[model samples]
Target: MSIINPALERPELIAYFLGANNYSWLHFRNGEKKLLSKPISYLEGRLPGFIRVHKTALINPDYVQSLHRPLRQKMAGKIQLQSGETFPVSRRRWNQVAQSLGEHLSPGNNEEPLQESVYLDDARPTSEQSNLGRSVASLFLVTSDEQNAFLARQVITKNWPDYRVETIPKSIHLPELLDDLAQSELPVLVFLDARSDTLERLQTLQRLKNDPRLCRVPVVLLALPTDKSVIEGYERQANSVITMKEGDMAFAQVIDRICQFWLKIAELPAHC
Candidate 1:
């Protein structure tokens, strides 16, 4: 598809595109930039060979050549296109972006079995401890991996900025975390990643739901696609048991779905 750049009275193919931040910027092979008015999300759905690596930016993977992990204060890594243009991969979407690059650059090898979202979010701004003081809703990001925790934080904070997180990788942390949340007078949501230990995690869920102070709060478990416990999650008092699928897109898709159902679609208690 083509669009007319009324500013220059010119039209161009989408191919010369480098990246977009809501509005896509096109780079002519000869080195000229034209802004396209369309939003990145719109292009992400329709444009082939492109990836949405940030909330505001969509990249043409064809031009991608390298990526650098987050710097000291940055929320996410940086992406470098073949033409040397770079864009930020939002902290929340870094895992997704990495996975996309992995799949794109190594299509044949990427066919390996998908893993549970072992990757955790690492980009939440640790500098602002004030978020914990708020009496609003809180999201308990329970995970074992650092990358997954960072990515999940990005996704959650983007939708619920006021919401704070408690990344509990160890089940040992649950009782204390939930207790603290209960006393805070904030609504709480638990996102448990149990790909590592099913039985123990189920026990953790059971203990969470049985507690009088926390029973009303929602708990969403991330289980493997084949885990039989998925059928038993509801019985264990889980609000939702989501299967963590595997692939390069696995990490990002998991975060997106969780935010959609838990934050956007579902009605949580006063905390949410």
Candidate 2:
């Protein structure tokens, strides 16, 4: 018998797995996918926490937002994830899926679909773009450096036009920022630059993580390319630590990828 380390498994980070024949596609919370050579049977035996919802699908129970069943038995049921992606639940698997989501299921109108925006990949066509209904989320770039803020804005404007960028100085009062973010009616993400006041920035990051109201909001630390800086940022509970790169073009590319992943790919928590 093999014991899976909780740290290594990080099952919460995985959304589900879709398998066919000898291959499997691993979907993540960040909207990233990985093709594995192993079959579904192989993974089902090895992974402990995943619930086999369908012949081809294995979902992490933690990510299951709800189980949706139609009024009539005309079609199969669905397992809706917090990420707004839904997977089919065969008739045979309905009982099993419901039992697995016993306590976790949201206690609203089961017949009504979530008002929150659905991904384009959803079975029901809500919109042409992903997260269409809730695209006006605020993105905060906490940096004293004007150049860094300008570069991030350019990339965000070009990639995520719906996202609004707000530049905040690192020296701002932590409590004021937290209070403002806690009252926000939309999703929020923060980018902190540690190039200048690295210690002060890390302290601010720690404070954000410690606050329960705003802890779910993703905070990415922009640190110098050093082991110490990266390690410290993680220790302070930064969601992600990206190293600062030289030159405008190179850094802009990095910012582009950042915007793509956070604003577009990753499913953010409903802060409101």
Candidate 3:
């Protein structure tokens, strides 16, 4: 449970290890974090029973609280700890990690139920009832701004726990997105940021629409409340144009509504 810090020559109990490049951060149970003068690979060899969930994260099963797996395999699963910290489980490492933490994972909650909506159609037949549950789709937000990506992800995860939000920074290759989505087993929704680079994002949207593989995927444009931007977005084949709100809370509500309609009401194509 304790390891001697090579530099400090003292024993320290670690909750987990987060690695960045050559350095590793040692997180303790008391919410204390120390920058260790060693790589996570070094600690892996030294510490026993610490699970390497991701390439950059190593966790102690004793501190694990629960494991969250998506209904679809397209998105990576996450490991939540008792300290309220979460780490991503990479697709390649998922099977190994799941088997290792088999006894620690919570039961009947691996796939959390979606938040109940007032408008769910309860009249669907038993054959179609399987698809009425939480969505297995992924949302790809295309933007260069880090804050925009963070806020969108925060909003999407809060509203739809089963859906995954991935940020595709600026200068993305449309063909690459198409190829990746083509290989995925589930569908994907694209959100283009048109607030700043209106023309460029619209062009990207046009490219997406022209591609046969991605043409069926819904592409929504996040833009300012300008008439020109909205008009341009539609001309380029954007499925929907959402105007940005003044405050963070209001903006998040906007995203929440988007999730309600796209992931809840609308039926997407089987493959993106």
Give each model a TM-score. Answer: 0.48, 0.47, 0.48
Model 3 per-residue lDDT tens digits across residues 199-259 = 7788778877887877788988988888887888889888999987433456556667887
Question: So what's the TM-score on candidate 1?
Answer: 0.48
Give the clashing pairs for model 2.
none
Which candidate has the highest lDDT of all? 2
By the lDDT metric, which is better: model 1 or model 3? 3
Order of models, best lDDT first? 2, 3, 1
Q: Give lDDT for model 1.
A: 0.59
**In model 2, which runs have C-alpha deviations exceeding 4 angstroms?**
1-135, 245-249
The TM-score, computed over Cα atoms with residue i paired to residue i, of candidate 3 is 0.48
The model with the greater TM-score, 1 or 2, is 1
Model 1 ranges with Cα > 4 A deviation: 1-134, 182-187, 246-248
